[model samples]
Target: MDYRNESSDTLRNKCAACYRQFNKKEHLVEHMRTSYHSVHEPMCGVCKKHCRSFESLREHLIGPLPKAECERIFKERGCDICLSILGNRTSLRAHRESCLSRPNNNGLLYRMANLGIQDELRIDNSRGRVVALACKMVGGGSDGSLDLCARVCLIDEHERILFHSYIKPNIPVTNYRYEMTGIRPEYLRDAMPLKNVSRKIQEFLCNGEPIWQIRSKGGRSRILVGHGLDHDLKCLEMDYPAIKMRDTAKYPPLMKTSKLSNSLKYLTRAYLGYDIQSGVQDPYEDCVATMKLYMRMKLSQFHKKENYPLATDPQNKNNFASWRQNELERMTPDQLLDISRSDYYCWCLDSQDY
Candidate 1:
């Protein structure tokens, strides 16, 4: 009686590994060999279906011809920014309210008012100065070959905004990427020119001291913090000393099991106990998230204080070859764990106090 189900079950070949269906058994075998679909593959947030790649996953969720059932549900409950399908309409509405709200000067005003400081905040002669920066991109050409910096924001350690501005691109914009970037052509039409923006950012980052002076002194220049800072800096045509940069994307603890860096959305949700970039990408939101992540890592209890200035210390070299055989054998497991190890020289080691 159930001929349709019986016939389909008998005819269709499925991979037990990834639940992918194939018309023929040999095809399934071939797919298993080449596809290598595993738990590590990116999965659809709505359907939990494994995609061959992130591009495939994007197509499944938001392409012209998505799965009808998943598309319907996603339309009602999914966040366009992070592409996550939340539980219900009420929850999604609450999330959208927070996600869509623009960051304002209220937080900065409160901090300044509380401190009772009328003078301008300056980074000059300051120690352990940290500033979070974020940038928004607009399409550069008709073929989407390039991205230009359209907006930038800077926030201090206290979540106080220092600078926020829109930058006009030199090249004509083919796409505003409004759905994610929340930038419009009108916003950039009368914005600051690229040259001016670059100069201003350089001044702020350098804090009145020359690059060489800051590199030698290590106190005048502010530590730049953000996610995917290389891309942002590339778009802005600006550069900072790598020693003074803290990029959350490349941080080891936040990476995937496969050793690939995690997305900011996932990192924020996992560590900060909330979601961001849900409806539109906000530079301010991103800055705050990155700053918070940096602070959290800095304040981690596992951090060893003995490894201060880990970059400059030649003795801190963790290579096993450098260690004496007797010393290595004599070391306890706990002492072995105490040996300073990092994916990259952590900038946290540069700060005397966080």
Candidate 2:
């Protein structure tokens, strides 16, 4: 089935969704089978090309060898951050102004813990909600090589402080990371113990449901949003099911063009249009940043309506049936794309369930 025997000028088999050329038609078919390119994928605003992720879309728009015409159009009207195409120069200017503006969450939203309270978060019993968690770490052990969670903060979807506490590490702290964390020796001297903080966080996140119940999907486990949650959770000596965790650093749409995780500061500026972690790191600020990011992603409304019976759906496994190979081979790339589905679940889908 090799097409290398054919002339170079002859039409080469190519994937309609990603535009990857194939030497054989069967290879293209196999690619469509595994790629699952659906309408839900991130697409270029200029050319209407579907990409595997936002990173891929960015590459298409502004990478080393972008589509010349598309790049020209995008350079004029495309939003560098969200990659949206605006109507005109004025609209693009206004859109960029608003798009890059930093969100203003009033300081009054903070509900600080009273000095008399012991290991208490003032959040009410409206369970099964989405919350963002962020923890600031201090250096522990000799030469400050080990990370210890010294502060943790949680905020509900509305950016209200649900839980915020300074944790006293089980081990002695060697570096409070004063310049970045602004945590002093006194903050940990009489702060809440790690065990108590861990228990309260676990209880709050689980919403009084047992681990098994939450794991079974029968319980209302609050969705945990964060950046680099694995590091935070590891430092805190706690574990949460992956299904309930939404790490902005790991979410495809918010990643770097290189497919690497972007730092919170970079993501905040690029996507959220604000700068964070500029000087001293605040867990509450991180919580708000992460929550804002989560909300923005969840509120995405621009993606085309999901196709029914997605290519990844079990029943749609035989997307290009062998019996219809002749018909599929004759179809154009755009036609093939119409029958494809996204390989990964879009985060916007979370809005529907939540």
Candidate whose TM-score is highest = 2
Candidate 1 worst ten-residue window by lDDT = 111-120
Which one wins on lDDT? Answer: 2
- Using Cα atoms with residue i matched to residue i, what is each candidate's TM-score against the true structure? 0.61, 0.83
Mind sharing the TM-score for model 1?
A: 0.61
Q: What is the C-alpha lDDT of each candidate?
A: 0.66, 0.75
Model 1 Cα lDDT, one tens digit per residue, 1-354: 897976685345555434666555545444543443433344567677765444455568778888888788888898654456789999898876644423344534443343211122455644237889888798877786598998888878887777777889988999899898877777888888888777777787888778766663346678889999999988998878877788888765455533578888887875565677777677777898898778766643233455333323566444233344445434432243244233245444544452
